[model samples]
Target: MTGDQTRKLALVRNEVDLSEGDFDPTLLAVRVEEAARRLSIGRTTMYALIRDGAVQTVPIGRSRRVPVQALSDYLAQRMQSRPINAVA
Candidate 1:
C-alpha cells in the first residue's frame, strides 16, 4: 500500500479502536466512508459494491450505514469464492 493509504488505514483503525480482532464488537455500524477505509477501497467502489449487492447497508435517518457484520460477511463470501490456491 502507498504511504497515504497506510496513513488512512491507521486513522480508520484508530477511529474504530479495534480490540483483539479485525472488528470491534461495540461498533455495530459505520459510515460509508469509514466502511470504505476499513475495506481499503475507494468510496466509489464501495458504493458500487452496495449497488451490486455485494455489500449491505442500513438506512439511518438521512444517511446510510454499513453494518460491521455485513463487512465481515462480504469478506468471508469473497474468500470462499476465490480460494488462496485458486489460479487467476
Candidate 2:
C-alpha cells in the first residue's frame, strides 16, 4: 500500500475515539477500503455486502463512500441474528 493508503487504514483502525460519539465529521463517510478495515473485513467482502444491500454506500460524484452509520447498522444486524451460545 502507498503511504496515504496506509495512513487511511490506520485512521480507520485506530484514530476514532469510541467514547466521544459516533458522529465524527471526518468519518461521516469513508472510502470502501477504510470501511472494510474498520470492520476488520476484506475489501472484496465489503463490496459484496454493498452489492447485496447488506451494507449501504453513498455516491459522491464518481466515487463510492460508505457511511459510518451503515457499517454500524450492518454489524448490529449481524450481531442480533447471531446464534446464542455459538462457539466464539
lDDT of 1 by residue, 12-76 (tens): 45564433345534668887877887888899999999999999999988888999999999999
TM value for model 2: 0.68
Q: Count the backbone clashes (under 3 Å) in each candidate.
A: 0, 0
lDDT of 2 by residue, 21-65 (tens): 342346688878778877878989999999999999999889888
lDDT computed for candidate 2: 0.79
Q: Which stretches of model 2 miss by more than 4 angstroms?
A: 1-25
TM-score each candidate.
0.68, 0.68
Every candidate's CA RMSD: 9.0, 8.1
Give residue 36's error in model 2 in angstroms. Answer: 0.5
